[model samples]
Target chain A: MDIKNMQEAELKAAIKKVMQDNFGLSDIADDADFIKDLKIDSITRMELLLKLEDEFGVRVEDNDAQNMLSVDATAQLLKKIAG
Target chain B: MASKIVVTGLGWSTPFGCDLDQAFDALFNGKTATFRTQNINLDGLYCQVSAQIPRNEAIFPFEKWQKELPGNKASMFTIFGLEAAERALLDAKLIDQEGGYVDQNLKIGVVVGSGIGGLEDHFNTSQVILEKGANRVSAFYVPAALINLLPGHIAIRHKIKGPNQSQVAACSTGAIAIADGARMIVEGRCDIMVVGAGEASIGRLGIAGFCALRALASGYNDNPQQASRPFDKKRSGFVMGEGAGILILESEESAKRRGAKIYCEYLGAGLSNDAYHMTSPCADGAGAIAAISDALYWSKKTPNQVQYINAHATSTGLGDAAEMSAIKFIFGDCIEKNSFAVSSIKGAIGHMLGAAGSVEAVATILSLHKQKLLPTINLEEPDEFAYHNDKLINLVPNNGIEASLDCVMSTSFGFGGHNVALVFGRY
Candidate 1:
């Protein structure tokens, strides 16, 4: 739950696990866009954001949810939130 | 001459396990899969017993299925349909080693049916709207809840590009789907059709809705296993059940060319309406008789040819008696003399509603393939109303009976007097 202390690699690994474990996407890339590459529709995006928030114990602003569409972007956002 | 349509494969994700042999064996043994559920507060609802798919626990774990379709926000009925479709296609060898299409140009079609689409999801979304803000509602709610999306998701997943449709006729939905799909092959509309029905409406709303109608068994809450006693003198009402049944139907020519393993021939379907009442069937069984007669007529077979019947007796008093009367009218005094065997699988699996017809159709086909009649369990004393001439119609009570069956009929009548009967013959 203390995602603020998670390293960049750990954050990325967690994100990858969420994609594979939660969404059942095994072929996701480090920079794969949720919408474009993974076919995550609008509803799924909301679900993914909620899941990320739950996993990281971080509050994702509505505006930031739109920007955090890729794993890399999500990791960056997590780092920003932690800072 | 009407083209012959044969079933090449069948799949079901039932409260009973999916293994055909095992499921049939359990049904033969009169094993009850229903149990008391805490999913819905029994204090608020009358019926406490339901045949629910065991989820994320011992027995049949749903976690593996969850992994297969991760983040699947679709309704559970759609998920069940997709899973059954996958199994059926695999059984038919329609998929290649790489899990791709065996023949991309096979002109396959899909017809799936459901009684109430996403009632659970609809209830949840409404709760979210009431408890949380309106903005908290998810976008997938509508797509997951819509009925037609059952086939739409299937076609998209399996790349089936021929005729696509979904049916809704309450409990008769499954049989109508199978009939309509078989017609597609007979009419040269498609060479192969994936047909069946899935239902997952055992949630609060689903149970409460039926409870309000006083259509569910309420007295056997303590003994859940005995809740669904179809065709029995003590039978009170039907027990709610949920699952899916999908069959791979192919033109006889196509099946022969592919060397497909044929299970049984889907001769034809007969459809009729009672025009009597919204919920109750015609007391004289006219609609049921006409439907069965029509099915026999469409199949060009005589009543004497039907060696077995998988009845749609939902354990309700009048419903069982009416169906028995219809069969007597069709088969005459021979029925009471055990000329042919008859049974209802509801005693084991309960009433599957929209999926009942297709599920029982699968049971009928399996009976044909295995040459064994499934027992109508819990029929301790066959209802007097189902008896004719001081004899109970060969209801195949208590234990399964082995018999050679050349042709069998499965009947399904829904809430709106929707009567459907389908005849299947040995391939």
Candidate 2:
């Protein structure tokens, strides 16, 4: 699941699924920072990291949590973690 | 320092029964409603045993106000507390006889305590992340799971307008709820207050979490009654129980003016902390002593004046001994004698945690009226800490028999090192 390597359409769907699943938000705005805009508290973000690993079948390095700012940034980080 | 307060009404939802009188009767006759769980799937767990109340005991039917509350611990507790409060207010005769307990004239308040608020809510919501995704989560999840909302829901439904708050200190929550309501009465903040604690954490996450900490007993899966032995030598760990115990506290002046039936006087309360560990107490028992000593001080009575102590003895490895040492500190030279009637119903009800304090307070008040010591069952052999188990009961063979009761005290120590004690006596 290298989110960056995936085609544009597939990546959008995957990000959509991840945001919808992890955050429980019916709507995910494109410019949304997964942390700030969603109001996902620190614990939830850590939980998000765990979910990412569980869903993507990858190991999210500790440093990757902070770099996971925007939903787009999260999609890119999945590429790194997946590698 | 403050005006006198009286217990005008009482309510409880327990494994024994729904109403307070029924529960008390079942409790007195030594009937424990605990049974082995054949329902929920709890495979990888430390304690397969639980003291679950019958499902039918739910105060309100489905599609009631709880439908608006959502599926969570708060949803369950809100419903339970509402039923308890409804019964309590009605019993106090504050409401209309034709309708029920609802009086617009009453200046009422509510204090509902929760040990761990809505653990089930969070656990179920977390699953939405795995299954339906984030958007599938309930919008009302945050409000439904918040610990403070127990009182919030109660106040919203009943329109209680005085002091409203939630007390949380793990297991000691219920005891603090009563004391806080007492303070409100003494301060003249409200004429009447409905107070109690509730928890509904009996799920896969709850059992798994406790198992993770190794804090639940795994010994008596075959027989649930024998599972929780508080002061016994072979006592392993506490059995988790859930429910709510509510008491209506009113000023003596108010109760006297209204001619309400009185249960007992809410004398004094004490609170302290071990400040030692996150979950464990300091073996020296400094916090426990401070709480008991202060409660005695508030009552303006000597330890000798006390006749019974409904101890917060959870029957854990260190907790039971810590409580004994604290009692020794308060009773001093008196504890060695047949000093006071003392027992932990945790052996019977498995430890009610959040509701333990209020439920045990009800038990202590019953002792004052009935004048008999409640037994700590499941004790085959007493441990080093409690050799006086048999001697704990003074008025013999007359369980629930009325006798002279000067004063009694109840104690609760919770997580984050929170400690509280309440003293009561006849009006």
Candidate 3:
């Protein structure tokens, strides 16, 4: 449950699980753009961010949340916040 | 006569299944769809019986829709509405095999409604607001809770670029939507209309709310099938039902131009308000009488001309009695002489709330087409009021009957005293 102690691979897996649960996208690539590749609109993007905040037990600011457009970026942001 | 509005196709996602003929067959054979609720948790609720769509059988194409829209985030009613609309379009031969419109030039509109729009979604969103916070609410909450979104999503999927509207007249919503769709075509606003209603509010909150109103059937939780007994002496209350019914209405000229098979001519529609009670019909059944009279007047048919009546008898004692009184007032000697048959499919499929009227309209049109009067199942012993002047009015109790039919009427009475009567005749 603690994202702070989780490995990079584990964090990515967790993020992919969330994406799969929300959007039914099981083959989400780590570097795929949320909007362009996955077609997650702004509203769905906000919902996904909220889910991530809940899952990782952290807060995401508006500007940083907007910039977390890919699974890799989301993982990096979560790591920085966890630290 | 004015340019006719004709029904070209019909579709329904009902408790019996999506196949119209199969569902109507089940109704004709006196089968009941009511059963104890499994999907909805009803631990302390007074009414525990409901008639829900057979989800596995009536499947929606979620995968195809997910590619374009967030299908998983859409409300259940919206999904059911989409399925029904697709089936109707296919039945009407308006859509190609890939579910796209066959004719790109026709101006096709949509009008669908619901009694309580997305109550289940609203309940879930409220829980998020309570347990988590308002900021955690999903962005799809507002869109999912809106009634008009059902029609909006249908329009988006089919690329329909014409007049779109939603009716919200409680149980009369489906009938009103059909009437409004016909009006659109009559007024030259559109050539074809996909019109009906959908409802999927059979959740814990919906059941509890209706239970609080003392509007749902009870004491038959263990015998759910017999809970909806319209016109029977032991009839108590209605069983909650959920589904969608969609019909394709086209102008006669348009349908002829396309060589579409016409189901029946939409002779006329009558809409009125009781203005006496919000939930109860006027004591004299004046509202229902006026609506039926208006429809007959508009259709230019006398009471004796109607061969069958799909009565809005929702298995409730007061409602059934009031409708009988209205029918008697309108068709006095006709009832006494058994000139026409009357039946209520609610006894078989329960009251489908917003979808009830259109589904029943489908039954009515089919009765005219097939020349069959569907049975009011569970009517073992008809009530005393079902008889007039020592002659039993043909309630078509517990058995289907074949009759020569040319004209038929379907009646829908909703909460807020909304009453609608639609008359259909052979094309």
Q: TM-score for all predictions?
A: 0.91, 0.78, 0.96
Residue-pair clashes per prediction, in order, are 0, 9, 0
**Candidate 1 similarity to native, TM-score:** 0.91
**1 or 2, greater by TM-score:** 1
Q: Is candidate 1 or candidate 2 better by lDDT?
A: 1
Candidate 2 local distance difference test against the native: 0.74
Ranking of models by lDDT: 3, 1, 2
lDDT of 3 by residue, B1-427 (tens): 2298899999888887777888888888888899998776789888998987765634345455565455346788887788788889988999875457546689789999988989998888899999998888887888888999999988877888788889999999999999999889988888899999999889999999889888899799989999999899888899989888999999999999999999999999988889988788886789999999999998999999998899999988788888888998888888766678889999888898998999899889988888889999888889988887777788899989889999999999999999999999999
Q: What is the lDDT of residue B66 in candidate 3?
A: 62
Q: Please tell me how candidate 2 rates in CAPRI terms.
A: incorrect
Q: Which clashing pairs does model 1 show?
A: none
TM-score of chain A of each: 0.89, 0.76, 0.94
Give the per-residue lDDT of model 1 (tens digit) for B1-427: 2378899988887887776777888898889877997556656787889888777444343675576555656788988777777778888888753224547779689999899989999898899899965766666778889988888878877778888999999999999999999888878888999999999999888899999999998799899999898888788999988888899999888999999999999998999999999999988899999999999999999998898889999988778888888988888756755778789999888898999999899899999999899998988877776667777778888899889899999999999999999999998
Full candidate order by DockQ, most accurate first: 3, 1, 2
Of the two candidates 2 and 3, the one with more favorable DockQ, higher being better, is 3
Model 3, residue pairs in steric clash: none
Evaluated at residue B162, the lDDT of candidate 1 is: 86
Fraction of the true interface contacts (Cα pairs closer than 8 Å across chains) found in each model:
0.62, 0.00, 0.56
In model 1, the runs with Cα more than 4 Å from the true position are A1-21, A25-32, A35-43, A50-65, A75-83, B56-61, B96-102
Number of the top DockQ candidate: 3
Candidate 3 chain B, run of 10 with poorest lDDT: B56-65
Which sequence of candidate numbers ranks them by TM-score, best first?
3, 1, 2
